[model samples]
Structure formats: C-alpha cells, structure tokens
Target: MHWVFLVLAGLAEVAFAFCLGKARLATGSESVGWYAAFAGCAALSFYLLNLSLAHIPLGTAYAVWTGIGAVGTAGLGVLAFGDPLTGPRLFFLATLIGSVLGLKAVSA
Candidate 1:
C-alpha cells in the first residue's frame, strides 16, 4: 500500500527527470509538450511521495524514493539516450542501491 505509492512516486520522479532532459533537448512545439509532461510527472511524484510519508518515516522514505528515481533514471538514460554506464558509475549506483536497501531493512 504505502510501499506501492512510494515506488510509484519514485517512478514518477524518473519520468519527470526524463521529460526534463527531453524538454531541454527538444525544439519548438516539442519542447512545450515535454515541459508539460515534466510538470505533470513532477506533481504526481510529489503527491504520491506525500501520501507515502503519512505512513513511512521521513528520512527512510525520502532516501528510498530518491534512490529508486536515481537508479531508474540513470538506467533509462543509458538505454534510451546512449548515456555512458562506466564501471565507476555502475559501482556507485549499486552502492546507492545497497544503502537504500539497508535503510529499508533497518526501518520499521
């Protein structure tokens, strides 16, 4: 329930980040749509995050939410936009994910 909302919020955060990148790279009318999508996703992400916060601790929820978004966005960038996934970058991303998992395990 709450976890689901948190996960969705994190996914929305990824959508927002992707839309932002697309908007920046787009031209003319395309940029407008991208910006609009970015705004919508950002709003949805925040709303869901707020909902989850009602149940989860602030620090734990926030860390996990951001962690999911960061990993998801980076993965998407690599697959969709040809962003580099160098060794060090992957290692650090894994570390972040581990930290997030650790936080979740320690939390109630």
Candidate 2:
C-alpha cells in the first residue's frame, strides 16, 4: 500500500512537471489552467509522499520519487516537446532506474 502511494506520488510529480512545461507553451487562460493543474498535482504528490513516509524510509522514498519524476518527465519532454534524447541522457536515466530499484530492493 505504501509502495502504491509512493508510485502514485512519483507519477503526480511527473504530472506537475508536464503541467509546467505545457504552461510554458500556453497563453492567457490556457497557461493559467496549466498552472492550476500544476498546483493540484504538486499538492497531491506531496500528500501521497507524506502518506508513504509512514512506511518507507525518507531517503529511499525521496530518491525513488524523484527518480520516477525525472525519468518520466524527460521521456515526456522527448516525446511531446521535442527535447533531445541523446545517448548519454539515456544511459544516465537507465542508471537512475537501476539505482531506484536497488534502493527499493534493499529497503524492502
């Protein structure tokens, strides 16, 4: 259950990042909407994270959460915003994934 919360929080973090990116590309009311979405996601992410902290270690949870957010946001940027997906960036993301998994394994 805590793990589920953690994953959801991480996904929320990604959503917030996506919202921010969209907000940047928007204008007037559209940008305001995106910003509102960002705020909602951020609040949800933090609330879920706090809930997960009841069972998960702070360091592990934080790392995993940010890991998910970073990888997910970067992937979305590449797919939606024309961000470069270079070899080095891919390599690092893979490494970050491994580290996050490693933390989960050890913490569990």
Candidate 3:
C-alpha cells in the first residue's frame, strides 16, 4: 500500500537523520557505516516519496512524512538518548500532532 510505503519512508527519514548525526560524531572507520546507512535510507525515503507523490498530493505527503519524522525523532531522542521532556517540548509535540491532524482533515 502507498500508506505503508509512506510510513516506511518517514521511518527511513528518521533513520537517515539519526545515522547522519552519528556519522558526524564518530571517527574514521566507524563513521563509514553510519554514512552508508544514512545514504541508503535517504535513497529509500526519496524513492518512496516520489512514488507517493504520483497518487497523493505533494503538499499532503510531504507534510505527513516530515511531521511523522519529527515526532518519531523526538521520541527517539527521549527514549534512546535521554533527552529532556520539558513543557515547551511537550507543547511543540502537541502542536505538531495537531498540525498533522488538521492536515489530514484538509487533505481528506
């Protein structure tokens, strides 16, 4: 399904973001793997996005993908990296979710 691929693309975007971040952190040999992962995910994300755009509106698909990617990345920051969940963070997260819902409604 396109939706499934879209979600995968979003997840892959998050993966690419994370790997690219790590690659920037590590030294020579270790960073190579990170860069490779980032590249692979980036390719997949772009491919699926292009495919989804054929059937879905570009604005809707792009918004959905990036919004979900933001939420997922923040979640990873909290759960995997022990990032703080301050009030402002929660507020932004709620706003992001709200925007996604509003977009869904408009797109529907």
Candidate 4:
C-alpha cells in the first residue's frame, strides 16, 4: 500500500516536471493556474513520498522515487517530445530501471 503511494509520488513528480514545461509555455510568465498546479503537484509529490517514508526506509524510497521520476520523465521526453534515445542512453536507463527493481525486490 505504502509502496503504491511511493510509485504514485514518483509519477506525480514526472507529471509535475512535464507540466512545468507546459505551464511555462502556456503562460510565458509561470503565473496563475499553471504556476499553482506545478507547485502544488511538486509539493504533493514530496508530501506523499514523505508519508511513504514512514514505512518504507528513506534511502530506498528516495532512490526509487528519484530514479523512477528520472527514467519516466526522460522516457516521456523521448517518446512525446522527440528527445534523444541513443543506444548507450537507453542501455543506461534500462540498467537503472533494473537495478531499482532488483533493489526493491531484495528489500522486500
């Protein structure tokens, strides 16, 4: 259950990063609804991650949250925004995802 929140927190952080770019593009000033939504999503992401830390160990959750957010965000960028997905980069990303899952499995 708590792990679910952790995953969600990571996803929200990804969404937050994505929205930040959109919000900036949309408003040009980073103000109003987009600003509020971006900040609010980021804040909520941290809060949820913190809550999960009570049961899940800070180090693991932090690593997982950061790792997943990074991977997820980059993947989205590659797929949606035509960012680079070079062989070495993809290899490294795959390694990261595998290691994160492996660690989680070992911990569990």
Candidate 5:
C-alpha cells in the first residue's frame, strides 16, 4: 500500500514535469491552466511522498521518487517534446533504474 503511494507520488512528479513543459509552450490562459495542473500534481506528489514516508525508509523513498520522476520525465521529453535519446543517455537511464531497483531490493 505504501509502495503504491510512493509510485503514485512518483507519477505525480512526472505529471508536474509534463505540466511545466506544456506551460512553457503554452500561451495566455492555456499557460495558466498548465501551471494550475502543475500545482495540483506537485501538491499530490508531496502529499503522497509524506504518506509513503510513514512506512518506507527516507533515503530509499526519496531516491525512488526522484528516480521515477527523472526517468518518466525524460521519456516524456523524448516522446512529446523532441528531446534526443542518445546512447549515453540510454545507458545512464538504465543505470539509474538499476540503482532504484537495487535500493528497493535491499530495503524492507
């Protein structure tokens, strides 16, 4: 259950990053809407993180959260925002994922 919260929180973090990117590309009222979405996602992410902290170790939780955010956001950037996914970037991403999984495997 706590892990679910953590995963949701990480997804929310990705959502907020997406909102930020959209907000940058948007104009006028549209930008406002994106920013609002950013705020909502950010709040939800933090709230979920706090909830997950009740059960998960602080360091492990934080690393996983940021790992998910980084990986998800990078994927979104490549798919939606035309960011490049070069060999080095792919390699590093895989390493980050491995580290996140390693942390989870070692933790309770």
Candidate 6:
C-alpha cells in the first residue's frame, strides 16, 4: 500500500539522519562507510516518498513523513548522541506525533 511506502520512507529518513550524524562524527575509514550509507538511505527515502505521493495527498504525505523522521531522529539523538531530552522537547515531540496520527486518521 502507499501508506506502507510512506512509512518506509519516513524510517529511511530517520536512518539517513542517523547515518549523517555518524558520518560527521566518524574519522578515518569508518567515516567513508557511514557517508555511503547516508547517501543510500537518503536516496531510498526520497524514492519511497515519490511513490507514496502518487496516491496520497501531497500536503498530508509530506507532513506525516517529515514528522515521523523528525521524531525518530530526535529519539535516536537522545539515545545515541546523549542529546538532552528536556521536558519541553518531549512534550513538543509528543504533540508532533499526535498531529501526525491525526492527519493519518483524517486522511483515511
């Protein structure tokens, strides 16, 4: 389904963000691999997004996709990069997620 593709694209976007962070932090040979992975993920994300857009409304699809990616990437940053998860940040993140879900429900 197109929704599946959209979700996959969002996940790919998350992976792309994580890979980009890893690539930036890495040095020597490891950096090269991370960079390559980042590029692959980015490509996959965009490709899947394009596929989803064929069926889903552009505004709805883009917002949901980016919302997923943003939340996922922020969570990963907290877990992997020791980024501070302040109360306000968590609250905003939850709000964003709720908005995404609301969009999906209404679109359906």
Best by the lDDT measure: 5
**Can you give the lDDT of residue 93 in candidate 2?**
94
Off by over 4 Å in 1: none
Q: What would you estimate as the lDDT of candidate 6?
A: 0.97
lDDT of each: 0.95, 0.97, 0.86, 0.86, 0.98, 0.97
Count of backbone clashes, every candidate in sequence: 0, 0, 0, 0, 0, 0
Candidate 5: tens digits of C-alpha lDDT, residues 1-108: 999999999999999999999999999999999999999999999999999999899999999999999999999999999999999999999999999999989988
List the candidates' TM-scores in order. Answer: 0.96, 0.98, 0.88, 0.88, 0.99, 0.97
Model 6 agreement with the true structure over 1-108: per-residue lDDT tens digits:
999999999999999999999998999999999999999999999999999999899999999999999999999999999999999999999999999999999995
> In candidate 2, which residue ranges exceed 4 Å CA deviation?
none
> Could you give candidate 2's per-residue lDDT for residues 1-108 as a string of tens digits?
999999999999999999999999999999999999999999999999999999999999999999999999999999999999999999999999999999999996
lDDT at residue 69 of model 5 (Cα atoms):
100
Better of 2 and 5 by lDDT: 5
Cα shift from native, residue 91, model 5 (Å): 0.1
Instruction: Please report the TM-score between candidate 5 and the true structure.
Output: 0.99
**Global lDDT for candidate 4?**
0.86
Model 6 alpha-carbon miss at residue 76, Å: 0.2
Candidate 4 vs 5: which has more lDDT: 5
* Superposed Cα RMSD, model 1: 0.8
lDDT of 1 by residue, 8-101 (tens): 9999999999999899899999999999999999999999999999889999999999999999999999997999989999999999999989
> Which of candidates 1 and 6 reaches a greater TM-score?
6
Q: Which is the winner by TM-score between candidate 1 and candidate 3?
A: 1
Candidate 2, poorest ten consecutive residues by summed lDDT: 99-108
